[model samples]
Target: MTGLMAGKRGLIMGLANDKSLAWGIAKALADQGAELAFSYQGDALRKRVAPLAEQLGSDFLIDCDVSDMAALDRTFDALKARWETIDFLVHAIGFSDKNELRGQFVDTSLDNFLLTMNISAYSFVAVTRRARAMMPEGGSILTLTYYGAEKVIPHYNVMGVAKAALETSVKYLAMDLGPENIRVNAISAGPIKTLAASGIGDFRYILKWNEYNSPLRRNVTIDDVGGSALYLLSDLASGVTGEIHHVDAGYNVVGMKAEDAPDI
Candidate 1:
């Protein structure tokens, strides 16, 4: 049971640092004996990702900018050359101009909107296409999303809209790939103080609000997210696909803030 992923190999995308949710999932998977390869968008992240991948007994780092189709082709090509197939893919990539993460969603510029959609939402589609090619026997694909996609979270802005699209893509892709026994799912995780969360406006307030109001009466950490991800990526979720599973400490179910909660 402990070696659930003992014979598996997969790719990890969007690892930034130790505190990243991707790092948490990678550690969990690696601890269960999953061999991993990592993708970094640029040279700076390459340096950061290399040591972390090495920590998991992997040095398979590839340079992939999902926004660029050519780079994605090269990424899978590299994987093809090394591993004939992969068992899973973890897509934790996302981005938006920090300037736009605040303010009203109506103020979203066309350029930024397109960029956010392409990187945050469509990148999953792009990478899944490549990953599916390598998963002839079928596999699992997981992406990181947020509760902001389902309901409004102040200042979540364009990223929320993008995540909405991402969640839909999971369903569509799941249908397209299910015949091959491939699965697609998303984890709508709760707040965690990672590098990405730092960009959101009033993030501290949002964290406090979730802590006060969520049924668990606290925010979730990357470890919490990692465990759920492990279940989804493992055979434990063999029957699960096209699901937007909530790892939000039951926050998504609440209709209103807790009556006894302190006002943020």
Candidate 2:
């Protein structure tokens, strides 16, 4: 281990299971000697997250529902009780109704639209508000985003809009926190077969399409994202902030399908 993060302590929000992007980020951080705390929303996930935390040699777990103000308050209160300050925070949370994920964007319901925005977009803001309080000494904040926010992906629909809003929030938050030496940024990762991704329609096809067309000729994995995240969260990226760094295998640069690509 490089011990690049040898003494840092931070919280990881929205980890669900082994295949989660959060899990990859957690492992990368832990391997670099960073101390970690994990947060899960409900009982079902509590069981899953506990073992993951233990695997990382961490027993600091908290129940946090970012959409709820009181739960957020309690989450940070618990964190503050344990550590007077933290060096970083990772937000890998997002959600949307599965039923709405398959249809046209025009048909998105108001309820689901609002719900998606609340969970996928605003939760970052909520958590950052509390996390910033503990970062008087300055720190790093990272969130996961996607290419769907910039280009229309079939079935990405409302979630795309939500991610767009989230990207904007990152820029604004970076500006708001820059004076404090706190950096805010995001990773627009390629499609990965995580639990949260299964909810999107024809996800497998999307994966395959990316494999054939991206400049790397493959879809990205959590490990790929983990490496990029590690850099952003570490002092390696101290000069960076408010950036939507793409970890999408160069997919964002393509204007048309590759000549060798096959139709999915």
Candidate 3:
């Protein structure tokens, strides 16, 4: 349909299922002819990713665990073997222990806090460092974030902090990789009903609130976020970097819900 990403090649991490934001972006890019490779955490995810990768005509699926350097090494190594250079990387990976995600920030256990940062924030930095090495021609790097990074979302606790750090890392990495013309940015999307989201308690409440307050009168979908992703990774957004683009149907711009509104 659209050929906006023609001839480009990108690697996408964190495609847990068809409902994933990463899947939405991948489908858009594939529709536009960007060659793609996917990475899954383990065999469980691999099964879901294989058929999807095949659907896009990509057989370049690899296993990667951000916490494991060995797995990270092999993933990029395999990509290098297939293509001398990569044009873009989509990092939709982030996690926090569900237990820590729902409580008071002050009560956060140091162990879980650090683990959250490592997985949700540090992984972005680590992956960018590796991807930059092979992007001699300069390319694009993108990560997913949330508005909670700036404002508190009741149960978003530690994950919000992690996303805040991840957003800052985007700026620093964008500056560091700038010399090479590599751009790094983030997308702060509204809530979606995905497997990962379902794990977060109180997600239903968050959804209902957004439906009533967001300017679009609805919650955002994976496709809406995907469209923004296509722009950032394409030459269309060559001048955009170190920025957090919100695809929340203008929800972030609102101060409060309408007075006459029934419960979302």
Give TM-scores for every candidate, taking all chains together and pairing residue i with residue i: 0.98, 0.98, 0.97
Per-residue lDDT tens digits of candidate 3, residues 164-253? 999999999989999999999999999999887876779998998888888888899999988999999999999998999999988899
What is candidate 1's CA lDDT for residue 68? 98
Worst 10 residues of 1 by lDDT: 1-10
Residue 211 in model 3: lDDT = 85
lDDT of 1 by residue, 1-264 (tens): 349898888999999999999998999999898989999889988888888889889989999999999999999999999999999999999999999999999999999999999999999999999999999988999999998898889999999999999999999999999999999999999999988999999999999999999999999988888899899999989999999999889898888989989977
TM-score of 2: 0.98
Candidate 1 lDDT:
0.94
**Number of clashes found in candidate 3:** 0
* Model 1 alpha-carbon drift over 4 Å, by segment: none
The collision pairs in model 1 are none
Candidate 2: segments with Cα more than 4 A from true spot:
none
User: Best to worst by lDDT, what's the order?
Assistant: 2, 1, 3
lDDT winner between candidates 1 and 3: 1
